[model samples]
Target: MRNRLVFSAFSAAAVLAVVWPFLFGGQLAWRDMLVLDYPQMTASNFGGGDLFARNAPQDGFLSIIAVVMPATWVVKALMVASAVGAATGAWWLSNKELLPTLSAIALAVANPFVIERLLQGHWSVVIAAWLLPLIAAAALNGRALLVWLLVFVASLTPTGALVGITVALVCMNKHRLVTLGLGVLYLLPWAIPGIIATFRGGQDMNPLAAAQAFAPRAEEAVGTLGALLGLGGIWNADAVPDSRHLGFALFGLGVFACVLLGIRSVPKRLIVLALVGMGIAIFAWLAPAAMAWALEHIPGAGLFRDSQKLLILALPAYVAAI
Candidate 1:
């Protein structure tokens, strides 16, 4: 019960500290999260005729939910809920030790990654953050069915679904094949259709050229490595929170360095996935040509032009590693 209270307090504080504006000011649409303009369900909400269907599942879910409440309220409420849900997911993964729990929660909700994603209006990514930890706990605890269900729902976002699929592969010891099938099942609704449409239409893009445009950015005074370690290099200057520049990013670097001490606590497969995730983020900067080639050749690889989302795959490992 005490741990529950701690979790609840931190979850609420995490949301209120950064997202009070969304809560008090009501719905504010920015970037990809412009659901306020069309709050109600329509025939078009479920249809993304073009490839990528980037808004799949989330936008459609919003349409159904908005019918229950005003769109403004629904938008703000979901934002608040996703933020709180992130912290709660961290707490769920913790071992009930106060310090470790606090550290895990901070990594989960208050990190620069969550803030940057939120500012960029990528609430679905934030929802994925929440789902990642929940799925991790289920996988770690040997709850196969729960892991499959959570991973299936993570298909709401393509990037999140990618990370979620990785979670099933790296974290589970049993039902690996069956769990992996759930990953494919989730993709069936959106990914397959989008890929087919892209090929059928021959909508070609120069992935090599586009890679530079979507590469991870250097942060203010901290540089690209620091920003990526600090979880702040989000490719859009406007998306980074102001606090990141005010010494918080440097602090995050130090904390992330210290987080490596508990590396043995996490499963080895999870560690490999985390390293691969960070490596992928850096690859765009170090080997843009190779990254672009993969983007050009790999089906749906174009979606990762903003490769930082790949770090979502590492969230579970980071929390456990710490």
Candidate 2:
């Protein structure tokens, strides 16, 4: 009960922190904010086409919500919920895994990757990130496959679906086949369309240029590193919210402590996972040639033109590692 309270309090705090600017009579407008314009929500809009074909199942879910509710409320609710969910999910995972409570919450909710994505107005990515810790816990415990299936369905984005499925399979040691089956069934909605689209010849894109364009900027990469340790901030000067300096400082301290703990106590597998995730993120920055080559030759690599997005896969590992 005490743990639950702590979790709830921190979760609420996390939500408030993210929305502080809005609470002060600010507005939500920037790249991708057009989705929040409620007037655009319509059946024709929602049913314009299959999401699987577009490889954005998550965006489809958001479109449906926009149609059903006022867009402003939907956006506000999602922003708060995503932040709270990420913190709560981390708290729950930490409790289940015997990790540090505060450290987990800090890394989960305020990670640079999450903040960057949020600032970038990538709501679907943020939502998927918030769900990752819970999904990891569920998979590890061999429960909630159905719930996870639903989450994957809503996540819709290839990165979200792939990460969720991969995590579940890796953690579900006792019920591998069952988990795999559920994942397949849940993904069919998107998979069938994606497969059909692939067969029909996908849209033309310069894979190499796309890869380079979306790779994390240097400051973004530094922020990703900081986030791995609970010090979440972005590289873009314009993206940082106002008056977050104290928060960033405290987060850095928390990250430093977590790093010490990780070196002393984290499991080998988790450390390896973190390194692999970091390596993938770095590959896009440090080895553009290799990244471009992989993007060109690898079948599904094209989907992750914004390879920095792969950092989402690392957050859960970082939490678990700490």
Question: Which candidate gets the maximum lDDT versus the true structure?
Answer: 1
lDDT of 1 at 162: 78
* Among all candidates shown, the one with the greatest TM-score: 1
**What TM-score does prediction 1 earn?**
0.88
RMSD of 1: 2.7
Kindly give the stretch of ten consecutive residues in candidate 1 with the minimal lDDT sum.
43-52
Q: Which stretches of candidate 2 lie over 4 Å from their true place?
A: 1-4, 19-29, 36-55, 63-68, 71-79, 95-100, 146-150, 220-257, 263-269
What tens digits encode model 1's per-residue C-alpha lDDT throughout 228-295?
88767888888887877776678767767866787777778777877898898988788889888887
Q: How many clashes does the backbone of model 1 have?
A: 0
Q: Candidate 2, 22: how far from true, in Å?
A: 7.8
lDDT tens readout by residue for model 2, 1-322: 7766766776677767766654433246666544543454333332234332443454455666667775556656665666766776676566443237776776787776777677877666777777777676665666765446535543555666776777666656677777678677666656666666566666676766776676655333335445433433333445554434434534554665666666544444345555665667766666777778887677667666666666666666677656
TM-score of each candidate structure, all chains considered together: 0.88, 0.76
